[model samples]
Target: MPLTVHQFPCLEDNYGFLARDEATGLAACIDTPEAGAILKALDTLGWKLDLILNTHWHPDHAGGNAEIKAATGATIVGPAEVTRISALDREVKGGDVVMLGETRFEVIETGGHTLGHIAYFDAADAIAFVGDTLFALGCGRLFEGTAEQMWTSLQRLAALPDETTVYCAHEYTASNARFALSVDDDPALKARADHIFALRERGEPTVPTSIGLEKATNPFLRAPRLAERVGVAGEPDYKAFGAVRAAKDVFKG
Candidate 1:
């Protein structure tokens, strides 16, 4: 059975995910952005937090780890690097599988935003908790890794089935939409951007972007075409990716 995923806004624009495995009724929090918010969400949903799955060691992603673990006694599982920032019960990396009831999450190492970052993909459920690796109409900023590493990570994610529902960490679609519009002139892209704008105006969340939608609209995934769109078509794939990332870093919109 597909896992029931509940996504709620956390500190600032971050999103916290609670995935409930139907068969076992075991629920796992995807990240610990804020303990109070996550606990409240669990209380409202009537689910207990059995696991804390961290994507990276970034404070915003793991800041509430100790508190949440103390409150719920949830077994914490994440990349070994998380110990650098917070406490963890089990360490995981690429190629490992984490089970939530009958649901199996295949861990994929996606190092870029953080060098040890990983994403969890449940192929049966067609869901991916991508942390800050990828986003709606955008990708995470390269922090501890190079653009090439980030590009490699994104390629791995882009290989997932088009139907996969990506659960990225932040609410960055609004700004990303503006940047996407600034570069791409495709009518379909413009339509999506306009819709994102309208949704944001209504105080709606624009996350959970599908893989197909991102492949068609996200500049980072469309690295081969980005250089052409930005009038630098002769560059290599990594160069194009770097250029796009750099532009986005300085882009106010």
Candidate 2:
């Protein structure tokens, strides 16, 4: 059976995801952005949360671990770094598989925005829960890792099947699209930006972007192709990516 994902906006810009396995009805919250919101959603859906999956130790991501666990008794599972912020019941890493009933999530090491950030992929369903690593038109900032590390992590995600559905943890697409236009002139990107703007204008969410869409239009993913524009001509691929990331850091748009 497929995993049913319930996505809701939480915090100021973050999103909360509740994924349930249809076969066994076991559910997991991808991250704990807001405790009250998550608990409310669970109550409304009447779905029992079996796990609290943390992507990193950021306050917004794992801050609700204690509260949610106290309320639901769900096991908290995530990378070891989550211990920096909250208690973890299971320490998962790359190559590890976590099962919520019969649904399986393959953990991918995506350490860039944070040294121990990870993503969960369900190959059977082509769904990925990428927390603060890769976004719709951008990638995470090099907060604790290096350009090479982030670039490599992105490559790992890019290697996934093109049809994969990526569920990023935030709604920064409009701003990211603006920055993308400043760097790349891809017609596809222009069309995507227009669509994204229209979606936002209608008060819609711009997440759950596909890997194929991002591969074609995301500026960070297209960094190597835009080396000269970013002033990283003849540099390594990671360097080109670094230049684009640096540009975005100060982008007023």
Candidate 3:
């Protein structure tokens, strides 16, 4: 069965919470930004949260853990390195699968925005909680990890089925779209940008983009696609991955 996922806004400029399955009484909150937001969301949906999944140890993402746990008694599951930082109830790494009720999720390590950052994928639902690693039309900034590392992380994600719906942590599509336009001349992106612009203008979200959509319009996802789109002279080196990374770093939009 395809598990249904819901997103709830949290914190300020960049936080989101996800809820899956209400009838099973099974729900997972991805990146608990504030205890109140999570609590309110659960209350609004009449849902009981059974697990709290953290993508990284960033305070904005995990700050509500202790309080939420106290209130809901939900187990906090996250990357092993986040244990000290997030005080996780369950420490897991790559290749681990989490079974919550009738749904299953696989963990994919995406060490870029943070060295220990990871993304959870529900093969059954074709949905992903990518956190800061992969954003719409762009990739996460190299913080604790290198440009190469971020590039590698995106590749792992890009390799997923084209239909996978990406659920990133932030609403950075407008800015990312601007940068994507600067890096690649795709009429498709221009159309997407206009559509996204209107969506934002109307106070709508431009996320939950399909992997195929990102594969076609996102710049970071276009490294290999660029080679196919345009020769662009001397761009076929093995480091073409890094080439796109470097371009995005310098892109001024």
TM-score of 3: 0.91
lDDT of 3 by residue, 1-253 (tens): 5566777667665756656663476888888877887788788887778899999888878888898889989999999767656687788777999877778889999998899999999987788889988888877777788766777788889899998988888888988888777767889999999999999899888777888898888877777666543344455432465567666677776
- Comparing 1 and 3 on lDDT, the stronger one: 1
lDDT of 1 by residue, 1-253 (tens): 7799999999899999999999888999998998999999999989977899999999999989999999899999999889998988999999999998899999999999999999999999899999999999999989899998999999999999999999999999999989988877778889999999999999999988999999998988887787976666897787798888888899986
- Tens-digit lDDT string for candidate 2 (85-108): 999999999999999999999999
Candidates in order, TM-scores: namely 0.98, 0.99, 0.91
lDDT comparing candidate 2 with the true structure: 0.96
Q: List the residue pairs that clash in candidate 1.
A: none
- Clashing residue pairs, backbone N/CA/C < 3 A, model 2: none
Ten-residue stretch with the least lDDT total in model 3: 229-238
Error of 2 at 38 (Å): 0.3
What is the clash count of model 1?
0
Count of clashes, each model? 0, 0, 0
Candidate 1 off by > 4 Å? none
- Model 1 TM-score (2 dp): 0.98
